[model samples]
Target: MLSYELFFKEGLYNAEFIKKFTIDFDLLESQVEPYTPEYASMITGLSADDIVTTAREYATSSGSMIAYTLGITEHHCGVNNVFDIANLALLTGNIGKQGTGIMPLRGQNNVQGAGDMGCLPNQLAGGMSLANDEFRARYEKEWGVKLNPYPDDTQTRTFDRLEMGELKALYVIGENPLLADVHMNHTKTLFEKLDLLIVQDIFLTETAQMADVVLPARSWGEVDGTYTNTDRRIQRVRKAVEPHPNTKEDWEILCDLATLMGYPMHYHNSKEIWNEVRKLAWEIYGGITYDRLEEEYSIHYPCPDENHPGTFILHERFHKQNPDIKKSRFVPVDYTEPLELPDPEYPFMLTTGRRYESYNTHSQTRFYAAGIKVKQTEETIDIHPEDACSLGIQDGEMVQVTSRRGELLVKVKITEQVVPGLVFMSFHWSETPTNVLTLNEYDPISGTAEYKACAVAITKVS
Candidate 1:
């Protein structure tokens, strides 16, 4: 809505970069015109003046950055939200330089590493597209095996396939989906329907307990490997302590399983596997060898060759190096209401998030005595005092929270932290099982569940 006023009238945006690199600027302007500050205020509850001020400050600032976490991505319109955020950066040219860009904070330490190593359903190492013929061919030749041209089902779709009896076996590693996934009751049912379930982890989590075969794996402190941090820095992780007598590293377990299944993986150590990765995804991990890391300690990726310096800021010289390659495109997206909204039946909107005291599903943090004693001993719902009064519920009183999918009992903490019509819960306790009350709705493109927003009804337990 303020694009013309800010970009043209006030001259706040980067006109030169936009004209050269970005496409569909005029279309994006038109698309966003309907979404005025007033319209946004009605949805977000922030004043129009505040919105305009924030926009002006963000656009006119010398350097601005936007960092978001799962709160933004765990929504039904998660992809659209990301596209719009990119549109903001593209509009103001808040990218391709120091102290300017969008960053998605990963939930776990190795989440970035996992994605970079092609852990997604439709990606090769270094985030190369599996559908791309050249990328697929390169991997197939290196591994000496035929690669699947088609993309596999996402986790959300895998559950659906399992429920329909299309998928028979599931091999899970380090994930406690029974407590982490939305609609917990449904997830449990789907797991029961699977013909075979194999779980590999350092801890016997709720999901592992149900697995037909459980493989004990070494923890992070006992593993020797490199971790690609959120900043794209590939740093080595050394063994800090000896692993359990029977436990093995995750890679070792996988290799042994593969050997038993007729495909032998003769990787001697983690470094050998890392060498293979450097050979395959040379463009990203090529220059980041273990030897170089031993000297430098850490280095950012896009280190294509041995002599090349590591990249600190991404796309800093992309347009300068290759004028033909447009830096990025503007994707205009409009706001959409959440999949499940508060109604007469479910009068409160419940959002789920993580607490500092406990990690997701309490898989590891539950073992920490300090974390348990310091804060978040158990799961509790946060509700506004007004809502508590209206419902005849007191602070610290046990209450039953129900959603369309399932229900759970949790203690309430009445405070002004949440609005009258909204509540908050952390999904770190298996006893409470917060995901049981969450909706199964997901974004079509990303397949991320609406864990951030769901409709629920809260009442005092009798």
Candidate 2:
């Protein structure tokens, strides 16, 4: 929407870059014509003039980047939202250069690493598709076992299957679904229904407490591994102190479990496991050996050979190297309203996010005394002063917040940070469990739950 406003209205786009690198320029212009500044302003509540100014600034800037978090993805139209952002970047040619490109700020330190290692159901290592015959055959040959060509169930699908009694067991690692997942009541119920629930974590989290078998895993300071940051930089981590006698390294525990089963995973240390990763996913990790990582301290991916330097900026030479190939395309995405909207009954919109002092679900942060004392001792719903005044609610007052899914008692924080008819809360407190009020609606493409937007009613507790 903003890109179209910049292109047709303000004429503030890189015509040379668009003509050389992209396709479907005419189609994109036509597709986005209807999304005027006024039209977008109506939906987003930002003034038309402000939207136009923002578009102009973004287009005219020498180098600009869009960095977003779960606020953009935790919606029913999350995938489309991302496409829209990418379209804007392509429209203004603000990508494939220094200080430019779209960046999704990962929530955790190693989320990028986990995804690169094929944590997602649909992808194999190095972002390869599971349905790709060549990729599947490579994995099968390397592992000496027949591989399932089809993609496995995602987290949302697994929950659906568990509700229907199809999935009998679950192995949770470093996650607290009871506090983190949307519709917490339903998630807890599904976990209870599971025949075997194994939770592996350093801390005995709320989810771990319910597990039939809880495997104690070593913490970050007591583990030797590589952590890939949000910028795709893989840095090695060394064990600082000895681990507890009962706890074990996450991979060692998994290897032991695998050995107990039919398959035998004869691995020694983290280096051996990393070497196996390099062997299997040569395209991305081929040159990223422990030796190189030790010598260089850190390196980004796409280092296909030992001598090849890591990729600093992606797609930098794509247009020059692959002249015949179109570099990118503008994906036209129409704006869609959130799944749930504020009504008379549920007169406010509740958006959930994280606090600086506390991390997701407060699994690790809560253990630190200094962090807890410095900021965010407990969870509180942040409401606009207008909403609080209208309801005769005071700051720090206990309130009852209810949505269709569930209700919880939380302290109130009257602030102008949030707009009228909108409230904000963090899902960092297990006691408050803000996800109890979150909706379970997910994006069809990404399967990310609608955690950012939900309808709720907040009332002062008598």
Candidate 3:
């Protein structure tokens, strides 16, 4: 906004108040290591005084739009980052507007749909808040499946159980979790322990290498479907060409699997499945149909009737009422240090992130620099100029970093963006796997790992 502080102009809220935080910034209480002004130091390398001043300006601003990608989500504090984002949005009242919202730039084409359709470990379709029973009952009635009453929200999510001899069968769809998730050694070990590993992908991915059954799947080019994008656009996509031999659409594959599993999912085609989805879906998809889509050419959901137009923006006025009003609680979140901190044994905090050159874990492509094959793909750590000079290192110098789990040799990129005693790396390569060196500990609330903070010993290798 034109105002000095964006959040204040828009009446948004921020959690930063009176706290000592950290020297580098710990966001702690006067004595507590957690939830202080030093918390600013946790995210930025500024001094405590500087952090307090900057945070005051930011938190008290009129309106602010939080922008984040894999860098925010791939860490152990990933859930906290998401929660923090939401908290900021709610606190500042920046949501329900044109210029401000917690924007999670989506990775793939259909992730939002998958999340909206309830493809997460928790919740049902339409991004229905999992704790709601009315939503659960609706799904049970629509699909005739006995729904689990409790939400399966786990921040430290792991299929590692499947590899650690805990879980049995696996039914993977388009996801290449083996390459996509952290801890390659652990993930591969988990894949090895599975009794059944079924992979369905347009191309045979690295994860598919260990699968017992590989089902050839149709690509987006050969499918007619509706994809939801980051901007909440429900756009239509038509089939452009025929899929290769023995390949079929994911809907057909799912229907077949359902039939085999003793649930008769008898759908003729993609259109048939979409029809059923629209009929049972209550909120946004109440009025959408393949017939209507064909006639109107394209339409967003929440139209409710043939005459009604699709929705573009979510926050207008009365329609944006808070449905979570029963025992709605505004939490006063105090900041906390990451679960793992660097000590004498490990003198640095090694944080892992992604690169803008390509997507996260997109390791099998030619353009990607796998294991130093390409310059952009090489493993590099972000450190401050002071820390780099103290360690007798320069930019692009090979360094050995050892964490509790494992180690990797990488080049260094010195920057002052991060606080001293903290370091960062990218988890995008297959050969130079970052997860091997990352702690598996997760947030108790979200099951997301504390990938942002891991104690490690960093030394110049050459």
Best by lDDT: 2
Question: Over the stretch 128-236, how does candidate 1's per-residue lDDT look in tens digits?
Answer: 7899998788889988889998988889888878988998999999899999999999999999988899999988999999999999998889999989888888899
Clashes of each: 0, 0, 48
Predicted structure 1: lDDT: 0.86
- For model 2, residues 1-462, the per-residue Cα lDDT tens digits are 363754677677778788888877787788877788888888888988888888888888889999989889999999998998988888888988898999999888899988877899988876667898987888888789997888888898888899999989999998999999999999999998989999999899999999999999998999998999888899999999998998999989988999899889888898987887787777887898899998999999878778888887887863365667556888877878888999999999999998888888888887786534656689999999988999999989999999999999999988898999899999998889888899989998888999999999988889
Task: Give TM per candidate.
Answer: 0.96, 0.96, 0.77
Task: Please give the TM-score that candidate 1 achieves against the real structure.
Answer: 0.96
TM-score of 2: 0.96
Candidate 1, poorest ten consecutive residues by summed lDDT: 1-10
Q: Which residue pairs show collisions in model 2?
A: none
- Per-residue lDDT of 254 in model 1: 81
Off by over 4 Å in 1: 1-11, 318-322, 370-373
